[model samples]
Each structure stands twice: as structure tokens, then as C-alpha cells.
Target: MPEISRFLGMIIAMYYDDHAPPHFHVRYGDREAVIRINDLACIQGNLPPKAMGLVIEWAMAHKEELEKDWALARQDLPLNKIAPLE
Candidate 1:
């Protein structure tokens, strides 16, 4: 997993070995979630409502970069930059 960004102790990352329509992991304290990139859906695990909101906001802000990274992921290429929602 590559640490894409961090905020308020929350860690956002992407796992190259992971599958499907591209997604990222959000870890905040003991909470975690696998969020799909295209639709911002929570495909697995759970995340607190407020935290999820923050993540959703971030994802929206970086949609373009995330989509680009997703394409690279499909090609099995390394991601040079994956910006977080700032």
C-alpha cells in the first residue's frame, strides 16, 4: 500500500495488488474503509459517518488524479502522484 496522504492522523492509501474498478483505503484510528474511486462507494468494511464525509470530500477533490491513478493501476504501472483532497 502506498500512503497517498494523511490528515488529522487519518491515512489514505492505495494497494497496487488490490483489484476491481480501483479504490483506496482510509484508516482513521481503529476505523477503516475501502472506497471505490469512480462512485465513491464503500465496497467493504466500515467508516464513521463524519470520517466518511471527510474522505468523500477528499475523493471528490482529487477525482481526476484518482482516475488517472486507477488507469495506471490497471496497467500495473507505478503511481507517480496521487493527490489527496486538500
Candidate 2:
């Protein structure tokens, strides 16, 4: 697992050669979210509403970067660190 971004107590990460649909993981406290890269939708897990909103907002801003990261991950290559939410 490699962490790509973190902000507002949330940790966003991705795994090398992970499963299908191209998704990233979000963890905040005990809450977790698996957001799909293609559609920016939560495919699994759950987070607080406020946390979910923040994650989605961040995702929207970095969609392209996220997709690039996904590609790198799928290829078992090094993942770049994305800018944290500001």
C-alpha cells in the first residue's frame, strides 16, 4: 500500500496491482471509503458524511492525477504523491 494524499485527518492511499475498477482507499479514524476512479463513486466501505464530502471534493479536484496514479499502481510502478487538500 502507498499513501498518495492526506488532509483533514483523512488518509488516502492505493495498492499496487490492486483489484478491478481502478479505485483508491480513504481512511479517517475508523471510517473507510473505497472510491472508484472512473466514476468518482464509492464502491465499498463507509465514512462520515462530512468526511465523505471532503474526500469527494478532493477527488473531483485531482481526478486526473488519481487516474494516473491508478495506472501506475496497476503496472506495479512507483506512485507519485498527490497534493493534500488545501
Candidate 3:
């Protein structure tokens, strides 16, 4: 997995040639979630309420970049880093 962004103690990453529905992985402390790019919904795992909200907010602001990253990841290409929440 490659990390695309990190902020407020949350780390966002994606795997090369990962599964369908185009999702990214989020890690906050011991918790983790796979959020879908199109819907910004958690498809797997869990995160604390605060962390989850922050993830959603960041995702919403960077949806297009996330989608582009997903495409590059599917092809095993290098991913571009996204700006973290201020």
C-alpha cells in the first residue's frame, strides 16, 4: 500500500491492483477503514467517530484526486500525494 495523504493523525493509503469499487484505506491509530471513492462511504473496517468525520471531510474535498489515484493504482503507477486538511 502507498500513502496518499496524512493529517490529524489519520493516514490514507491505497494498494496497487486492489479490488473493485475503487476504495482507499484509512488508518487512525489501531483503527482502519476502506472508503469508496465515488460515495466516500466506509466499505470495510472502522474508525473513531472524530477520525471518521475528518476522513469524510477530507475525502469530499479531494474526491477527484482520489479517483485519479485509484486509476493510477489499478495500473500500479506511482500515486500523487493529496494535500491534507488544514
Top candidate on TM-score is 3
Alpha carbon lDDT at 18, candidate 3: 87
Q: Give model 1 RMSD, 1 decimal.
A: 1.6
- 10 residues in a row with least lDDT, candidate 2: 31-40
1 against 2, candidate with superior TM-score? 2
Q: Write the per-residue lDDT of candidate 1 for residues 1-86, one digit (tens) a residue.
A: 77777886679888777888689888999988999988999999888888899889988998888877777766778875655556
lDDT of 2 by residue, 1-86 (tens): 79999999999999996899989999999888899988888999999998999899999999999999999988889999999988
Tens-place lDDT per residue, model 3, 3-61, is: 99999889999999788999999999899899998988899999989889989999999
User: What's the C-alpha lDDT at position 25 in model 3?
Assistant: 99
Predicted structure 2, TM vs. truth: 0.96
Point out the higher-scoring one by lDDT: 2 or 3. Answer: 3
Error of 2 at 77 (Å): 0.9
TM-scores for candidates 1 onward, in order: 0.85, 0.96, 0.97
Task: List clashing residue pairs in candidate 1.
Answer: none
Model 2 residue 62 lDDT score: 95
> Candidate 1: minimum summed lDDT over ten consecutive residues — where?
77-86
Q: Give the TM-score ranking, best first.
A: 3, 2, 1
